[model samples]
Target: MEGEEGTQNAHLILARKLFLLTHPDVQDIEKVRLREEVFDAVKSDDMAPLYETLAADKIIEMDQSILDSMRAKIGDEIRKLDEKIADAEENLGESEVREAHLAKSLFYIRIGDKDKALEQLKVTESKTVAVGQKMDLVFYTLQIGFFYMDFDLISKSIDKAKNLFEEGGDWERKNRLKVYEGLYCMSTRNFDKAASLFLDSISTFTTYDLFPYDTFVFYTVLTSIISLDRVSLKQKVVDAPEILTVIGKIPCLSEFLNSLYDCQYKSFFSAFAGLTEQIKFDRYLHPHFRYYMREVRTVVYSQFLESYKSVTIDAMAKAFGVTIEFIDLELSRFISAGKLHCKIDKVAGVLETNRPDAKNALYQSTIKQGDFLLNRIQKLSRVIDL
Candidate 1:
């Protein structure tokens, strides 16, 4: 019993620390006071009212049992807040009423009523409040953005947050907003844009000692590997010591990088397969699985093609552990995209790699160079009246 009690106490202590870390004051005195109250309740194990308060504050990480309990108790909480709102409206200004609405929105979100929460947010936005209150609203909107899976709304909330941070000269929050924006770009398969955003955010995050350093580095390397060519990746990511250090610490990522650099397609796939589900299901990466797979396959095919002038489709399919039809389709895509300079013979079941006609290309290049020289000389002569 003593050991169990000790474990429970440890859990509560950790929870309190997490709560404090996550719930910043944002210059709102009421919020700071409420956070203190929540901490006190946790310390004292006075949980009944604490649960409702946490729910209304959107601070509780809910389980089904907790959700049911909150549902049963939410109406009373809402009623009490509504009464308080009425009293505030009668005696105070719009700011207090806005706070009440924000509180009510948290309860609505806790109960899975997004529509009501959104309505409350609209009301909150319409109210003329202090900068602190407005910043709090931006935080709330970002929460709603994630809950709703609405990218556009998330982008708008980020913009609001960025504006607030800019006015306050909060460089950390501004950089954090860039990280969020980069993640949004990644989810939409804008790899180049996402890579650029992540790279820009890395220095800011690192310099400020931000908590998302691992995440930023991971995505920076991943996006660069996927989106950039080998030469660009070498220059942009692989050569960067800070990013390389992080990659070295993560074994799977390190292996992936090696495989990519070495053109070991099979090893690269193996490393990718060993990645965590969280990495695989990342909001920006999940949708691009098909495209990424094709890209990897193309890399594998290019390497395979370098060893031979021609190869049987069946042989290629078997080597790659895929069906002939799959290989055929992928090859066609590579050919059409000009990624693989090759021709496929359907009847012969062969892919014939084409070597560039260097003589013809050089002849054409020389002709263009001669024509350019003649044109320039003619222009120079005219200028000199020669």
Candidate 2:
């Protein structure tokens, strides 16, 4: 779980920079500082192509003089790399040639020239012969995908990595892939799949390039809360040692998880309220913040209603620390949308649970299927006679 530092961390920093760029609360001075930091980072890498691209896009002012200086250094460095590749290839040395190509690939990625970086990685992959090495190359490509938030590239690279693993890969790389794919799924709003993947990697996690172990646990808890049933949440998360170790460190995460599972509605609501700002500020979770809030509310309300055949609106409000009117409106909306299996008694100021009968539902489903089969048999007989 070693953290990335120095120039190797440029891409991740750039990804966060992109998020801060769009933050409404970011001050003008912070924007100026951000620009300077980004410029210093790219310039330190001697990224002529990336600098020119930024200047062309008006992300930064063009300094022709500075561009010329970077281009000179870049040209000299790339030429030496090319020379090494040529020398190695002339001697039919696969490993040296692969190393040279990989050096070039990393230079492009460090310079933020994504298309060229991908092209060079492909060249490096061609020189690579081992399945593990090929999977590593795909990991590099996946890094580029996340750096640019290019979903298509990330998706394709993940598929490629999985296929390479099927051809035989080490356990370490496969575990790392789970983290990458889990993050992608979370960013894309597939919380169910993301939760499963994150839970699977909770103990086996070895990669710190994506995030810290604490942050990883935080994600596992949040996603599992919304996706898993109460029983599974208790079994997998509330009782999981990996989660119990770190959940208390993350703000409100402990209260949020335990309050809901313990049926402490007031505490759950308070904890959930405390977490709203964090969710809103998060780059991945912000997009689905409202949907997540609704789902959490649904889960809590369903859990509360499951224990009561009928409950006074006032008592339910007191239980959840909300107004009677508020609970009435909330239950009405959920019931009308068919999300809750209960109805509100506005006239009597109560909520009446009407849980569906499993056996009856199953019987109806079987009768429908049997009717469909009978019709299909009749049609087949008619066809045969014809």
Candidate 3:
């Protein structure tokens, strides 16, 4: 009898806390009175009335543990709420019905019925809701996107979020969407676009004092290194004040960036090798690892071509810390792609670089200039005739 009384007192305390926690602002006299009634119902252990009060109040942020307790004590009542959700439209207005669906979804999620939860979410998505409620729905949709690796849905969710927050005067949400969009681009191996987005996000985060500045800067520098030319990197990222501040804070990233900038292939590769597993396993970075590595190799090989007139394949392999066969294959790719004006001597095991013919280069430049002049003249002629 003592234990039973103790349990009842605990329940009463929890019920009161829940009511207090969720009660609307004091200025709202109607909500305050309703919440008092709900508190009374909770005190009387009349959970049916308590649930109705909570749903009418649109209180969906209750702790999962509390909901779990409610489920155990009055599960049939909650299940009945789910069944009645479809019919809610006949009795309640659309907004109230959507609130009921949202509440039902939360309940399903807490009870480990994700499919039902997703089903409820889908229904809620089709209905119109306020901006705040829409934001909540999009957030939950993004979570589902990540869980299932639904890239298409994730992309759509990102677009929806951007549209929702673009003019909503929410700088933080806008910048966050930019970061997620950048991550999606990075995952798709669209390094150029990703680099641009990351730079913009870094600027916003820095200006607004957003958290995760370190992560934003990391990806910005990394994507810039992979996609941007040295001149662009210097102008857009390396010399940017916000990015420089971030680099100053993250020492390893600083070292890596410097190594890449200075064309120190050995140091750059070593720095990358020492990167944390967090970077390696990052959802965005993991998929692009091979592509980024290849870009790094291209950067290294481009530098090598400019530095040496001829280098032995063995020496190149040793410098790059790779096998001769690997070096040969990479060189073959570069040569075939016309990115490197070089030829490999198989017998001599030498990579001979070819400088562009000055006469041919000058001739090509003259032709390009002449074509531009002709196009201008034709445009001027047309203007004169007109």
TM-score of each candidate?
0.58, 0.88, 0.59
Candidate models: Cα lDDT each: 0.65, 0.86, 0.67
Superpose all Cα atoms of candidate 1 onto the true structure and report the RMSD in Å to 1 decimal: 13.4
How does candidate 1 score on lDDT?
A: 0.65
Clashes of each: 1, 0, 0
- How much is 384 displaced in model 1, in angstroms? 46
Worst 10 residues of 2 by lDDT: 1-10
Q: Provide the lDDT at 121 for model 1.
A: 71
List ranges where model 2 is wrong by over 4 Å. Answer: 1-9, 25-33, 47-68, 363-386
Question: Candidate 2: which pairs clash?
Answer: none
User: Model 1: which residue pairs collide?
Assistant: 187-284
Task: Assess the local accuracy of residue 71 in candidate 3 as a C-alpha lDDT between 0 and 100.
Answer: 55
By TM-score, rank the candidates, best first.
Answer: 2, 3, 1
Model 2 C-alpha lDDT per residue in residues 1-386, reported as the tens digit of each score: 11352123456766676566566777778889888887887788887776887788777888989988988888888899899889888985789899999998988887777888899999999999999989888888888888778999999999999889888999989998998999999999999999999999999987677667877888898899989998899999999998888889999999999999999999999999999988887767778889999999999999999999999999999999999889988988899989999877778987899987899889989999999999999999999999
Best by the lDDT measure:
2
Regions more than 4 Å wrong, model 3: 1-100, 106-114, 126-133, 162-171, 206-212, 246-251, 276-279, 306-330, 333-341, 346-350, 354-386
Q: What is candidate 1's lDDT per residue for 1-386, written digit by digit as tens?
A: 00121132222233334334453433366555646665554433324444555567666543457546545576677789799878888988877877777777665644445567678777777774565556656655555555445788888887777777656745555565676677767766777888888877766563221124565677777777767777777777877777876777665887777777776666776787776443544544656767766665666577678878999999888776678998899889889988887999999999999957799879989999999999999999999995
